[model samples]
Target: MVRQERAIRTRRAVVEAAAAVFAERGYTAATIAEILERAGVTKGALYFHFDSKEALARGVINAQISDDYWVPRELKLQEWVDIGMTLAHRIPKEVILLAGIRLSADIQGRSLFGSAWPAWTQLVTDKLVEAKARGEVLPHVTPRETAECFLGAWIGTQFMSEVVSDWTDLNDRISVLYNHVLPAIATPAALIRLDTAPDRGARVVEEVERQQRESPVPTEA
Candidate 1:
């Protein structure tokens, strides 16, 4: 068990190190040696988890979407909003997500390893489908189409924010995105109830942490 846990930690470290390198230097320019130096792991350890740099980039992309920190909400639309806002909040801080964004935007790297957009689009599509089932979305809204459009807007917003404000205004840009897009797709009741505030991501994270702390731990019977 200890060895398995160690391996998991080692793999995670390698991925994160790779992310940092990839975020700083484009995939074409990034070197395995730099990732290893950043990871503080041996070559054999990195190779054991990832066969190549391409594999490492793929791992970084895969790690971009995780719901472990999220708490479920009664409103599916609000959950969707939380996902975007939380990502906006985290992107500037998290190397992995930043790397994913960088790789997805790199023409050469994207051609080689594929972009994370499809996965993100599918994630949003699934959430929108759930929201539609819950009657949170308008009747004319199509989940897949909406997801694709929203993701495109999100990517553009991130890029513009990065260029203009160095991502200092990403949360606000995402809030504005939601404000503009939601009114078109979300039901009036859902739109009214949803919190699209720029500071919502931080608040939601705090709330999730509070809930986790207040809830009793489960034990085997």
Candidate 2:
């Protein structure tokens, strides 16, 4: 049991190290030697935890998936949407690594979810479908398409923020998403509540800043 626990910790260390290094340097340029150094583990130890660098990269991506999305929150549609937007704020660094562009350059056997993206997307899509049925979404929009659009905008915004860190503030970006972007897709009834619909926006921003101070950077391995 002790050995199992230690192995879990070691694996986590490697993933967290990869996230930081990949975010810093990117996948194509990052190497096993660098990852091993960052992880403070020997190459043999890393191989013990993971079969190869490719497997380690998958671990990093898997860790992000485990961190990012969840269905058990059992939140209402708008609540789910808000949570999704809030978490989207954390995606840029993770996305770069997941795309195999920064840290997982050699990882190519499967997609991020390993045959489960559609399942996950369906879970989110279901919530949007419910929202639309309740007239929370605009009447003209289809639920699946609307969900895709919502995700696209969030991802695009995150990517742009990653590239032009100075041009965008995460807080301001989410506010714009809520006050401006959401209104475009929301029904008038939903739009009306934007003024006072429980400000998780502030909470999300505060959490990001808090994580920045406490963690200093991403750490998932």
- State TM-scores per candidate: 0.94, 0.66
> Could you tell me which residue pairs clash in candidate 2?
12-221, 13-221, 16-221, 26-102, 27-102, 27-103
TM-score of model number 1: 0.94
lDDT by residue (1-221, candidate 1, tens digit) is 67887898999999999999998888988999999999999999999999988999999988888885576889998889999999898888899999998888888777778889998898889999999999999999989999999999999999999999999999999999999999999988898899999999878878777887899466332
Candidate 2 wrongly placed segments (more than 4 Å): 67-75, 88-123, 133-135, 166-168, 194-221
Regions of candidate 1 where Cα sits further than 4 Å from its true position: 212-221
RMSD (Å) per prediction? 2.5, 6.2
lDDT of each: 0.90, 0.59
